[model samples]
Target: MGLLVPVSVMAAPPSVGSVSISPDPAYTDTPLTATPSEDWYDEDGDPEGYVWRWQKYSTGISDWEDIADQTDNTLDSLYFIAGDQIKVICTPFDGVESGVDVEATITISNSLPTITGVTIAPDPASTASTLKATPQGWYDADGDLEGYVWRWQKYNTGILDWEDIADETDNTLDSSNFVLNDQIKVICTPFDGTDEGVPVEAVIVISVLDYSGSIDVKPGSDENPINLGSNGVIAVVIYTTDGFDATTVDVSTVKFGPSEAAPVHYAYEDVDEDGDTDLVLHFRTQEAGISAYDTSVTLTGETDSGTAFTGTDTIKIVPSKAKESVQGNEDAPGQNKEPGESATGKAIGKESAPGQNKEPGESATGKGKNK
Candidate 1:
């Protein structure tokens, strides 16, 4: 015997028996925690500091990739997809040589789901108009889209906040309640047998049309242009029928004819004392040079939303007078005598001279007796 010497052999690697992965049939893009069985052991009974290496094999690339490596006995699953295979191995070292890798595998049976795109048929939707939410490009890891729910919401400007559409749960919205520059958002969520998944969201803007108010010409408005007196005050009453605040009417949009005029005096009050507020505006007709004999008094204005409103009334002007009067029936050279009887009961072509009385049917050319 050639000096028979007993040599010490290095212990074998630790066997990480079975890998228990919570949610084995995990959904794609969802996290799953993997825990190795406690039956793992090193032949030398020194498994401390054993290295755990996790690897993944993707069907898309047909290759194995090293995902993570640590001393811990657990693996945090991330970004796994259907037909993807994952494995964890433990290597134990006996101070000098490394042992074999004892491994276990877990295959992903499901994939991730997603809502790729969303749209509105008429993106800039109008108030009281139908708005339909069209969801496009959806993917279900499980290849099913039967259990999906949706909700719509609007950004409110009054309180400067978002308001949920309580009564709307369908994919199509009818008679949308939108204001100018309204931001609308929608959310879609997945549900599977009473289990709810994460939700996806999309946003769109609603362009509402501006509001236009109806107008009316107040009573006593002259069909003919009435002469403007020295004061030149022309009173106007605006009947606001729009949904906008009349008190906040845009002064720039308020115009008389083609001329612009600042409100000399304006108030939304009960001018007629009828207990109802009326928009009253005063314009200096003379100052605006709108005292033409015949002119159209065009009242034009707009709301804060830039909607146009207009009212027009025709009028005619005349010479200024303290009071209207009837023509006199006095006689004069080359002046035709009054065709009708005078107020004093004198017939036509007959008039009394000063301090004289004329008989009925007597010509004024004839000498009449003095009264």
Candidate 2:
């Protein structure tokens, strides 16, 4: 039993019962924190602290690899991504020696991508122009590669809802597929080859293409005279020129004069004496709304293919005899006479009877009459 006098015992290293990581299910966007159980103990009852080591499982290396400069208790989200396994080792230390390592692991979950600055170009899209959808910024927290899925839709008045355009999956839409006044939209969805993000959209309205064409009012007549008081028809001719084809005009869509009068009748002919065929339309004079002060009138119509065109021609508005008689009476003093009386209150010219033809040498006003 020798030196039972001074037998000294060495203190055991500190040890912890278990370790845990907060946010058990990890995401790429959030930071992770490791915590050790308070049940840690030291044989010598010395103060206890922990040394943390972070690591990640590498599929390429088929083993766990240490993360550089990440020995702290907490690990940053930027270091890992979805489908990645992250672990932290916590070793309890009592200043003299370190205890067995306690590890906690978590697997990162899939994260969605974000889309920013989505826009449709050609700011105001037109039926004759192509439309393109663009996204200025696309981001994914998990550092995943990104792709886009595009879908185009239009507002349908018949269904009173937004309907998807058939086979319009590309980012660009052709001009032939849309029409004026049509409301169009493009949707973009971002994916990371594993998951998809919230979709972003851009909207626009189609506008008409205004063009000018040649027209002749009262075709073949040098003076396109219009009697304001007459209940008759006025003929208008639309000519086919270098780029415009009058034959393509949609007769049902033609509108003329300030009244927006529609055509009561239509025909095809070479009214302009040109070899190309032209469109001839007839509109009721009373319905044309032409005024004596209107020097020019406009005709607007669309082609069968939906192209809008406009033309203007000079007009000569003529007043009726009744209107002329009233004007003459108002302009002359003491000239108010009956329908058959002269301005002097006389019954025509004493020599010439009503409806009688004037002699070859005599003037109609009773001037140069034979004695």
lDDT of 1 at 250: 70
What is residue 241's positional error in candidate 2, in angstroms? 15
* Prediction 1 TM-score vs. true: 0.35
Clashes of each: 5, 0
Which one is best on TM-score? 2
lDDT of 2 by residue, 1-371 (tens): 67667777887899999999978677888999998998989988999798888999999989999999987789988898788898899999898899999998999888888888579988665556689998858998877887888899999999999999999998999987787778999999987888888899989988544332367675433345666775556666676777778888888889999999997766675433346776767777778888889988888888899876666787777677653432222211112222222222222222322211133544533322112
Backbone clashes counted, model 2: 0
Assess candidate 2 and give its TM-score to the true structure. 0.52
For model 2 the local lDDT of residue 152 reads 95
On the 0 to 100 scale, the lDDT of residue 297 in model 2 is 89
Q: Write model 1 residue lDDT over 7-48, tens digit each, in one string.
A: 988566555455556576665556666565677566767644
What local lDDT does model 2 show for residue 75? Answer: 90
Instruction: Give the poorly placed runs of model 1, Cα more than 4 Å off.
Output: 1-18, 21-25, 28-112, 191-197, 210-371
Model 2: colliding residue pairs = none
Q: List the global CA lDDT of all models.
A: 0.53, 0.72
